[model samples]
Target: MRLIPLLALWLCLTCQSALAAPVRVLNIIVGEWPPFVAEQSKQHGPVAHLIRDLFKEAGYEVKFHFAPWGRVYSLAANSQLYDATAVWMYKPEREQDFLFSEAVLQEQFVFFSLKARKLQAERLEQIIGMRLGGDIAYSYGPELDKMVADGKVTQQKVTDVKQNFGKLLRDRIDLYPQELRVGLAELQSQLDPASAALITHSQTPFLRNDSFVMFPRKMPDSAKLRDQFNQQLQQAIASGRYQRYFERLARGEY
Candidate 1:
């Protein structure tokens, strides 16, 4: 009778321990946007580190899956494999497919051009007839998008940033607009010192937009996860921890 009681107690303890284990894992999909989210950078870049820390505070472990930008958006929207996608700028069309979290980062978009060309544009209209290079499926905000749609500016679309940069270098495209830090990181990583120096960006920013983490609408717990993430992010911001991540990013720590 004593042995039977002890065995029952042991089973009960084991069950309790199993139930208490922390097994919440978030499968997040992302793309290669250096100095923010990159497979090769430290802690997978600052944004990744920020996201991981925030989720950690919420009692979740984040597992990042990197793919092409197009595929990242498509998979996160249509497939059940990924819980969310990170660091996307807001667009009305995107809201249809995913629930967006509070703004993660604010990005400044500017036009990159060859210094030799002496290109100076205070506004999009100033460069009305120039050939612009752009990444496929990217939104350059409503103003520029309308300009392109109205044929005020000619845009040549490519698969990735490298291709657009290459086109700009080769004079195939006169300008390429991209996030400031991201464009600089790409130049540093892709071009030689002299070659990189030849490229420069306009002083005026074309768009200043906030980017967010998007949870797929199809996921049952998407709203809950987004709410939890937003709460953690707000707390971090209030405590000044959120700004520290960007400080580290500025110092090239990430």
Candidate 2:
């Protein structure tokens, strides 16, 4: 009967709709590293925007959860609450617990000092006796860490970048090492023009390194997700979209 045919068509459509797969969502954890990743910035900063777009191309949506750096790293590594964490510099020891994506961002760290001091150091050893302001939770690099451990350099530890810069301005610390862009962004946001102008970084880089997104090794699909992300990232780079994000960042669009 005509009624039967119409019901059959309706059932077929219903089955097809029900069978369609839902878009997957990736819950990613991140910390405050502005101009790269920050909770308050548009699309959570440039690197985060790039990551979202790459995942969108791969048919996944990203939900970012921001926390303190130490908590962010610890939660992502030990718990299933997050699918991954972003923008971590490579450390061989971290390989045991997480799988790293292809290099996401290249960071150049330099020493910021009072313009009056005009501190310039080609090597960590060059600034050995000077008091270095540092984030207690963050690692500068292996060489700098070793120097601090061996008591080759005097380091004054603080809880955050803002504090280090504050100490720098107060003449409490001789030098503070931070990523070039991140340091500039922090100065612009945290200090008035006069105060910010007093701080300048060295021309020579203290450290140049690449950062990456990391997935917990315990996750069953971590490798697969990382591989998919890498593929999308490479394609974006080839299509010139990846570079465009950074261009926008330079223009303060993010």
Candidate 3:
């Protein structure tokens, strides 16, 4: 009868509508960098929250997988394990493999040494022959990287920031480079109170850099996803949501 045909048409339309629903899910690899993206922080920290909010506004679902920086970077760059990885500084080699988003956060690289060492360096040249502690695969901007590469500065690699702090306290290294606040936080949490108190960071920052999220080139529709995320991120900044969120984060208001 006419009702049978109409019902069949209606069911077909409903199925088509369901199939057409736009729900794009992205798996983003992230490393544990506190106050930026951490498993224990509220909403997994501000940068993580910003990424989630921006994509969600554009009708996308974001799932974050936390891992070591090396593992996260490798998986995101070489495999289909992740659609994106976050909080990396802009690097030319990385640009070849992934598309970088606008900077979501800014931080300064500072030198940390024991209070008794009397260590001070106004320039990279001044630090020549000094042992610098840093992560093996990480980039500390062009100047520092060049210093390490050219043998102007002796570099020691550690698995974590806390290890660097430990090495510095034990006088195994001359100086450790780290973000000021992040280094202080790690010191307070990972070191005994006396050792943390004996450590001090330089007043002069070695490098000021911005952090960004990266979308892998291998992901299907990566360009489209980047465009969508960039659009939403701009809207967020224009509407003052971005600034407000960052301010709240700075105040530890979560």
Candidate 4:
């Protein structure tokens, strides 16, 4: 009788503690794309760093978690395993299952090809007849994915962005779509200066436009938290800390 009563008391106390505490990002999760977000075990990415500081300044403590891109998102959207994630464009289909904070940073992805292939392709429509290399089921948009599923162009989906670079270098595919910031970083790390320069050519400037990061929308108090996040994000950018963080990470200091 005594042991039973004690066990019940402990359970009640545990539940009460959980219910009473404000959620300070009980969990953070990200996908496996380095420079953006990638880790074999830990969860540190350029976008992740922005989120870390944003919540920290808002008086919330957070912990980081790791999972593959698809699994991390599905777990958050389904099981509530994490409170937030960073750097994805907003999607209406996922709106009910997740919350979106304001855009903290902007990024763009564009098509790349060897200089010679320029004569054949100039825009998304022109790629219809050419083979395209991408990060495999990579999201450009809902309509873009539909195009792939409908077999408008041949897609060579690779495991990582590096593989896409290789295919581009070898002329295995005529075009590859990649984020400009990330692509430049990877080329610097993987190839000699001259070799890297000759590897691929983007369409002079970025063709596809997309904004990224500082979004988290799956916590218990997602709405309240997202609002708080946006305020801090605006202030962070105004105060210069945000720009510094981006610069440091782009330079690989973080």
Best-performing candidate as measured by TM-score: 2
Clashing pairs in 2: none
Q: Candidate 1: how many backbone clashes?
A: 0
| Superposition error at 12 for model 1 (Å) | 5.3
> lDDT of each prediction vs. the true structure?
0.92, 0.90, 0.86, 0.68
Worst 10 residues of 4 by lDDT: 206-215
* Residue-by-residue lDDT tens digits, candidate 3, 38-154: 888889988899999999998989999998877888899888878889989998989888998888788988999889989877567778899999975688999999988998898
> Candidate 3 — which pairs collide?
none
State the local distance difference test value for candidate 4: 0.68
Candidate numbers, best TM-score first, in rank order: 2, 1, 3, 4
Candidate 2 stretches with Cα past 4 Å from truth are none
* Local error of candidate 3 at residue 184 (angstroms): 2.0
Q: Which candidate, 2 or 4, would have the higher TM-score against the true structure?
A: 2
TM-score of 4: 0.75
Reference-based TM-score of each model: 0.94, 0.95, 0.90, 0.75
Candidate 1 lDDT (Cα, whole model)? Answer: 0.92
CA shift at 99, candidate 4, in angstroms? Answer: 1.0
Mind giving the per-residue lDDT tens digits that candidate 4 earns over 157-188?
87777788888888898887777777776787
Worst 10-residue lDDT window, candidate 3: 117-126
Clashes of each: 0, 0, 0, 0
